[model samples]
Target: MVVCFVCGNMTAGSNVTQLFSRSQRTQQTPFFPFLEYHDPAPGASPMGDDWSVDACFVCDALLAQQWESFERGRMPIGKRLYWLKRPSGCEIRQPVSQIELEEILNEHSRGNLDDYSDDEGGKSPESKPQDPPDDTPRLICYSCGKSDKDCPSMCPVHCKPSYEQLRTGVPYYPTVLDTDKSPGSKVVCESITFLCIGCLPKFPPEWHAVQKDFLRQESTQSVLPRIPLPEVVSCYTCGTDVST
Candidate 1:
């Protein structure tokens, strides 16, 4: 299902279409189609094979206005576009490909910075600021626009109150009892293994709640109690004494 990247509104079969400029002469294409364009990369080209469109017509218009301000020199190119939903912050709201930015940097590196120099034969005041590396990862949520740093410690979806919570004074707490705590409970490890948040699969709604509870409990139990081990016991069969 194609949903608006900004508002999450259903876009399938909607008359609304976002026009993406291909070139000065070429006509802008209706990019709201679900069959070919949706969930494109951070800076995917509109005419490329991997061209994906996430914003709906509404967002596209809003972005266009922002880009107009950018063009008017009223906004810095490096400044984050307020209406664009993508965290990459590479969206220029224009047809200009990201390669153009790279070429500007390349020319400057070759001591040909004069190529982009202003009319006074110096660096152009209108020259855009360089963007960050394309591979830089965004730490924002896919569903909500909030950054991971801004999001709550628990998953937002799982934290939503359910009907049961509304009916009763106590809220429901879910646990994934079927999930194994440890592959081998007897096994001990010196260090913890970690998985990237991106690598983790989309967990079920209850799983998130369970995970939150588990973490809370683990935090509480992190300080091991001062219980003493029992005194050494003797084995009756072999008459061997063992320490517990």
Candidate 2:
């Protein structure tokens, strides 16, 4: 079994899409060409070193469809949102109210959405803005800077969320890269991102053929389509794998 870095879902090893840094890809799997740091996925900073990302079943298809675009120097990322069904209660994220969501969407559109909280300048608030209680920590996406988990108050992840993420509207989760038990794990805004769930992925008209192509991208042989496992979901929480 492997864990996907994008949506944090569990997948069988054979059904995964492994995106290696240029060097790693050339050395391990050369079936596909690799992209250099000079051009990373849209809105993401240059990947600094050799690293790899695992995409689960659904995310793999999404990537395969975009592989051609990547070759064209346009790497689209952090542009979609997915809802994970958590049957049991979630510990890290709380339901956000509609009003709070609007503030996150409309007001920040003109300015940098990722700039919602500027901590530098060491200035104090002129007046206490009407917000949820201060205990719940704040989380903003490094990509699109959209949805977040918070109490009517606040919430916190492995670490504090930051205000430096680029706005790509893609749901980014820093914790998704590692198991929740990994040390130094934290969910900072610069390391996380959330897109408005409203934006949907555009599936091609010949969707079934595309899905078949996706499942076989790594090899010519067809593999079973990967299904969502509600039993295991990486809660956008502190990057921990949560089993419902």
Candidate 3:
């Protein structure tokens, strides 16, 4: 019998059947575009079969530090507190109080809503003042000192037409191409903006590379493989195949 993660119950329901089927599908079947994680029905929290847990970079770092502390026999109080302070966005439970240690077998238990409310109400003594908003356009291309205006020719690198023009579908530049240039060989202005001389891409190359790597890692780590459906087999007592 398979166990449910959320309620810790042994269920012989279709949910467990479906989970095993999904696992088989991942191992044997081809990939489908539409397949994705489906949440349990409203008010019906399934056990170990459907739910999954994924860790972010911050959580992974915190876990590593905590593990080290465990090895040293000196529990890291700060690391534990950091996890308690934020939402994990996971179905897994977390220990909320010392009293739970006696009742719970797992290291992590479901966090108490009451504890969260108490933490929010208690304010730290060293809160900093909020900063005022800066009216100036925040984005400034390194190649050009001038702030990108809400115009077609604003950007030097990407030919991003003004946001207003894009939304309104109004032509910002009369024509993208210069009249003097040759027909086929001439540079055609698709959008009004001038190209950026230095770093024109939306983000710096290094930052983009880092972002892509992070996305790849996150996707691989977080995506759970689907199980395949069980084969239709006839019961020994009956001739007819049993439907799930």
RMSD of each: 23.9, 35.3, 28.5
Candidate 1 lDDT tens digits, 1-244 = 4655444566664644444422122343322222132344433323333333455677778766765655455332234234445435333243256666444324323443343345786744676889976753234333323444443332222223454434343332232222333332221131112112442243333333444475578444367778887689889899899988
**Model 3 spans with C-alpha error above 4 angstroms:** 1-123, 138-149, 157-244
TM-score of each: 0.26, 0.21, 0.17
Local distance difference test values of all predictions, in order: 0.41, 0.39, 0.35
**Which regions of candidate 2 deviate over 4 angstroms?**
23-50, 70-244
Supply the global lDDT for candidate 1. Answer: 0.41
Q: What's the true lDDT of residue 23 in model 3?
A: 21
Per-prediction count of colliding residue pairs?
0, 15, 26
- Provide the clash count, candidate 3: 26
Candidate achieving the largest lDDT? 1
**Number of the top TM-score candidate:** 1
Q: What's the TM for model 3?
A: 0.17
Between candidates 1 and 3, the one scoring higher on TM-score is: 1
lDDT of 3: 0.35
Q: What is the lDDT of residue 63 in candidate 2?
A: 55
Query: Which candidate would rank higher by lDDT, 1 or 3?
Result: 1
